[model samples]
Target: MDKFVTRSRAPVEEQEVELGNLPADPGLRIPISDYHPNLKDKVRRAYLQKGACQPSHNFKKRKIENLLRRFNLNWFNEYKLWLEYSVEKEAAFCLYCYLFKSDNKQSGDAFVKEGFDAWNKKERLDLHVGGPNSGHNQARRKCEDLMKQNQHIDVTLNRHSEQIKNEYRIRLGASVDCLRFLLRQGIALRGHDESDGSINQGNFLEILKFLAAHNKEIDGVVGKNAPGNLKISSPDIQHDIVNASAVETLNYIIHDLGDDLFAILIDESRDISVKEQMIVILRYVDKRGHVIERFIGIAHVPNTNAASLKVCIDSLFAKHGLSISRIRGQGYDGASNMRGEFNGLKSLIMRENESAHYIHCFAHQLQLTLVAIAKNNVHVGSLFNMIANLVNVVGASCKRRDILRDRQAIHIYEALAIGELASGHGLNQETTLKRAGDTRWGSHYGTLLSLINMFESVIDVLDTIVDDGPSSEQRAEASALLEFVQSFDFVYSLHLMKNVLGITNELSISLQRKDQDIVNAMKLVKLSKLRIQMLRDDGWDDLLAEVSMFCEKFNIICPNMEDNFQMKGRSRRKVHQVTNIHYYKVEFFYGVLDMQLQELNTRFNESNMELLLCMSCLSPNDAFAAFDKKKLIRLAQFYPNDFSSVELMMLGNQLGTYIFDMRSDNEFLILNGIAVLAEKLVQTKKDMVYPLIYLLIKLALILPVSTASVERAFSAMKIVKSRLRNRMGDQLLNDSLVTYIEKAVFDGVLNESIIQRFQHMKNRRGQL
Candidate 1:
C-alpha cells in the first residue's frame, strides 16, 4: 500500500534508522542519506522507537600530562534525550543530530559525522545544546516531528487525494482491459482515421468506448468526464501500458526459471518491412517438472552475421540479469553463420562456455538431407523437374483445371463401375497438382501422389492443348511433357520417391512436435534409417513390378527386363552394354536409396547418437525399466562442473539405491518420462534426499531437442507485424510480441500493478 503512493519528501532530506537492528556503536553506523528514499521515514521512526543507543559501561580513565581524566557517564542524565555513548570509539554523540543533521557546516558536526570523544572538556557538552535556533535544537525538532506519523509529507498529500486515486484506478483498469484484448489477439491498435467523428476510431479507443458505455463506473472517470490532462487514452500512454505488460511477463518467466540451467533456441528472419529480427526462446524444466519453452524477446539486428548476433545476444542477457555461463545447450538451423565449426554463433558461445553443446535443428537437417540427395541423382532430378512442368502446363488456368477435373471424374466413375477402385466417405475428392517446395520435402511426396492419381486426366488436358492450342509454344511444350509422362524412367522415379518419402515423412513430423524428447526423437531417427536400409536391400523387385504394372495399365511400353539397355539419347552401338536389370536395379534403384541412407548416417553420426542413448537411460518409461546406473553415471560425467570426483563417487552409489527405491515404490510406477519423474521426486521430497540425482536430472533437461519454439515465434511475428503495420518501431514490436506470445503470464498480471508501473515510469498527470 505504501509503495502505491508517491513519496513527498526529497531523498536527501530524509534519514533512515533501524530500531531492532540498529548499531549500538556510533562508530559503525551509516549515514542516513545512504538509505533508500522510500525507506527513509521508516528508518527515522525505527530509531526514535528504540530511544537512542546509550550503553552504561564503567568509565575508563586516561592519564593526560600527569593528570587523570575519565569520561563521566553522568552526562547522560544531563542531556538524557540526545546524549548517547559508543563503546567502540569511546565517544559521546548527540542522537538527534546524528539522525537529522543538515548539509550545511555547523558547530555541532563533532556530535554527528566525527563521533565526539573529548571527555577532558566537561563544558563542551553544554555548549553543544546552544540556542533555540542552533543545529542541535533544529535536529531535535525534526526527530519530534518524525515520531508523529501524521506530520509526514507523504501522508498529508495522499490523504487529500483519496477520491482522485479511486477514479484513477477505475480509468486505468478500463485501459488495461482494452490493452489485454488487443495484445492477445495480435491486432493493431491504431487506424487510418481516428478522429472523433470517424465511425471506427481503432481497436484500442473503440474497445474503450464500448467498455465505458456499458460500465457506469468506467464512464464516469474516462473520456470527457475525466480531467483533461489525466486522460489515459493517448498513444504515448498506451505505449507505456504495453511496455509495462511486457516487463511484467518477462519478469514472471525469469522468476519461474529461478537459478536453474536453461538452453537457448535462436533464429532470425525478415519482417514485413525487411528488418532482420532475431527471436530467442528459453527451454527449461519448471517447478512442476514440465518442459517449458518461453519466448523471451525479439531483437532487431543490423545484420545476420555471427559477430553482430553474439553482441546482440550478450546485450540481451545483460539487460535481463542472465549469465552466459548458465547456458547448457544451443539449438539453431544448419546455416554456416549459425552452426559452422569456426566463427559461427554456436562456436562463439561454445568458446565462452565449453559446456554449451550445439545441436543443429533436426527438422531442418532432415529437409536439407532429403533435398540434397534427390538433386544429386540424375533420374530423380529430371523426374521432379518434369512433375513441376506437368502441374504448371495442366493447371495453368481455370479452363484447363476444369478439363482436368471433368476427365478425372470420368475415370473415377468408370473405375468404380468395374470395381477397379474402392468408394468410401472421403474417396475420389478433387485435388490439383502441388508444387514441391525446396525447403519442405514432405510436399514432394504429396506432389507425386497427386500425379499418380490424375495421370490420365493430365494426359487428356495435354492432348487437348496440343489439338486446340493457345499458341505454338504452348502446344510444343504440352506435347513434350505428354511424351515424358508416358516413359518408364518417369513412372519408376515417381513410385520410387513416393515410397521413400513416405517412410521419412512420419519421422519428419515427429521431430517437429513441441513435446518431443531427445531419446524418442533419436529412436525415430534410427527406425527411419532401418526402414530405408530395408528398402534398399530387398525392395528393388517390388518397386520394378509396381512400375511395370502401371505402364501396362496406361498403354506405355515396358522394356524387357533381360534386354540390353541403352541410354535415352545414346545409341546402343556406342554406349556401354548392360542388361535392363543392371541399369534399372543396380544403377538407378540402388543409387537413390544408398544416397538417402548415407546422408542420414552422416548427418546423425555415432558420437552424438551415443550421447542421446546415454540420456535415454534416465527415462522413467515402463516403471523405470530403462534406468541403468552405469549409463546415468556416465551422463553425469558430461557436465564436470555439476559433479566433481567426490560427488560422482557418491552419485554412483546413489544411482544403485535410487533405481531399487523407485522400482519398489508404488508412487513412481505412474511416471511416464524423466520430466514427470523429476516432478514426482520433488513432490515426494526425494529431491532433497538424493540431491545429486536431481541435479543430474536438471542438467539433462537443459539439453534442447528442437528449435520449434523459436520457429513458432517467427510465425507470430507475421501476424503482429503484417504489411499494414510494417513501419512499427522495434521497441513497440518487441514489447507487443512479448505480451502476445506469453498471454498466460500477462493474464495473471494485476491491473493495479500495471498502473503503478506506468505511474513510476514518469510523472503522470493522474494520481494512481
Candidate 2:
C-alpha cells in the first residue's frame, strides 16, 4: 500500500502508447514482384547504393531428401548479382531485371515482380538468365558494366595496345639509336643550323636520318613519317631519353652500392654560366670489389661557403634518398672554406656523422707539396718563374714554335753526328716545352725534362732572339736571358730541383691513378720520402757532375768550384764572399732539398701515416698482406659505434678463422678488392661469419684516396655547360653529364626499359 501510494503520482499517461502504423525501414523491406517500373527502379537504386542486404538469419529453408536443408548460401554466392532473396516474402528475387527492366517489357514474374517460392523448381534460375541479348542478360550486362569501372587495374593494355607499342618502339628505337651513336662519338647534339634545308642539322637529327635512310623499319617510324606529337627526335624527347639513361645508370650504381658505407669525393667550381656548382662523386667498393668512384651528382649552389655547401649536400642526399650516416669519408681540395676546422663543410658533415672523416685530396696534396717546397726558397721559386717565362716565350706563336723545333732538329743532328745523343722511337719524337701549372701533376717534371732534352735547341733559340728580336729592348732582354740561362748557376739549380722532383713525380702520378689504393699510395709515399732522403744525401755530387757534363756538351760556361760565391742579382754589398762549394753545396742544394723533405714529412706526418697504416690493413690486394687482424682491431677504434667492446673482442678470432677459410675458398682467393670481397662473402654466405672484419674492410675501402674523380667531373662540367650552352639549367646539365660520363652504363640499358619509363610518365594517344 505504501509503494502504491508513492508511485501513484502518474497513471496511464506516464507511459507512451502507439496509436498508428509507422513507415517501414528501407533496409528491412523486401523486394516485390511486378511493381511500377519507377518504384522498383527507385528501390533498386537504393539497394545498389546501399549494397547487397543478404542477411544470414533471414535466409529461407526447406526440407529436401528427408533432410532439413536450408536454402544453400552457395546459390546466392554463385548468382550474387541477379539472385536476391527476400525475408518478408520468404522468396527469391532477381536484382538485374528489377533495376534495369523497362516498363513496356514483360518478363516471367517468378523472380522479379513476384517473389519465387518454388524451391523445388530451382532450374528456373537458369531460365531467368535467358539468352545473351535477352532482357535478363542485358540487365546482367549493365550490372557487370557498372562494376567494371571500379576495378583499379585500369592500366592494362587495350586491343590497340600491341599496335601502339610497336609504333612507339619504332619511333623511340630510331631516336635512341641516333642518340646512342652521338653519345658514343661524344659529338654535340645540336648545330647552329637545324633547318630542314640544312644538310647537317645536328648529330642527333643527322644520325636519326642516316639510320632511317639505312633501315626501312626505322624510316617508316621516325621524324616526318611519325605522328606529329609522336616524333621522338624532338628536343624534349631527346632529353627525356637522355634522362632515362642517366636514371637507369644511377639505379645500377645505387644497386651496386647497396647498403654498404661509402665516401664522398667532393669538389666545387664555377660552371660555364659562372654558377657555383658542387660535383659529388661516390667513392665506394663496387660489387666486383673494385674501388669505384662514380659521379653521383652535380649540385648548384648560391655560394661556396661551408653552410651553403652543406645545405646543398644535405638536399642532394635527401633528394636521392641517401643517408649522411652512410658517408665514411669526404674528399675535397684543401681550401679553408672546405676544410676549415670550426665551420667547414667537412665539420658540418662530421657533426651529423662522426665517422665521416675529412681527407684532403691526395692528388691536390701532391700538387701543394710541389708548390710549398718550390716557394719555400727564393732560388727554387725564381727557377720555376724563369722556366714558365721560357715556355711562354718559346710557345707563344706557332712560327716561334717551328723555329724552336727546327733548332731542336739541328741540335739533335749535331749531337747525333758527334755521338752525344741516341735516337729512338719515343726518345726523339718532336718535343715541345710544356707549360708548368700549379695544379697540373708532373708539369714541373715535364718542363724540366723537355728543357734538358732540347737544351742546345733552347740555347740556339735564345741566341737568335738576342740577334733578331723585333726591337732593341726585346733583343737586350733576350740577350740577358740567354746569358743567365747559359751560366753554371742556372744549370745547377735546374738539375738540383729536377732530381728532387723526379723522386716524387711517380708518386704524384700514382696517387692520381684511378685504381690506386690507400695501402699502395701510403707505400708510395714512404718510398718517395726514402728516395728523396737518399737523393739529398747521395745526389749532390752526381747532379753536379751531370750538370757540368751537360754544360760541356752544350758549350755553356762552367764555373770553377774554388771561385768566390756570388748571387745572381746585382746588389751593392761588401766583399764578404764565400766559396762556390759552400754556396752551392751548403746554401742552395741543402736549402732546396731540406725544405722539400720538410714539406713532404709535414704533409704526410705521423697522424696521416697512422691513418694510412690503419687503412692499409683493409687492402684485399697482395694476398691480403694489408689485411691484418691485429692492426684491424686497432683501426676498429676509429668507428666505436659500429664496433664496440664485444665486436672488437670477437673480431680478432673471427678474422683468423676467415683468413684460414678464405685461403681454401676459391672465390675468396680470387677476390681482389674490398668491393669484391664484400660481395664474395655475401655470395658464399660468410658475410655474417666475419662481419666485424668485413665492416672494417668496407670502412677502409670507402676511405677516399683522392678527389681526381670529382675534379674530372668539374672539368667535364666545363665541357657540358660550355659558353655556347651556358644558359642550360642545372638539372638539364646534370642529366646530360650523368649519361655522358657513365656512357658505359647508359649503353648497357635496354631501349625497352627506357621507352617504358617514358610511357609511364604520362598517358599519351600512343603507348611509348
Among these predictions, the greatest lDDT belongs to 1
Question: Candidates' lDDT values, in order?
Answer: 0.79, 0.69
Query: Where does candidate 2 clash, by residue pair?
Result: 33-113, 33-114, 34-113, 289-675, 289-676
Model 2 spans > 4 angstroms off? 1-165, 413-427, 570-576, 606-609, 617-630, 656-688
The lowest-lDDT stretch of 10 consecutive residues in candidate 2 is 17-26
Taking the tens digit of each residue's C-alpha lDDT, what string does model 2 give over 77-178? 788656765544556777667656643265556666556766666677888788888788887676555443233134344334676679777878777777
Q: Write candidate 1's Cα lDDT for 112-217 as tens digits.
A: 8666766778788888888999888898898887665445566566553779988988999899889989999999988776666887678998999899999999
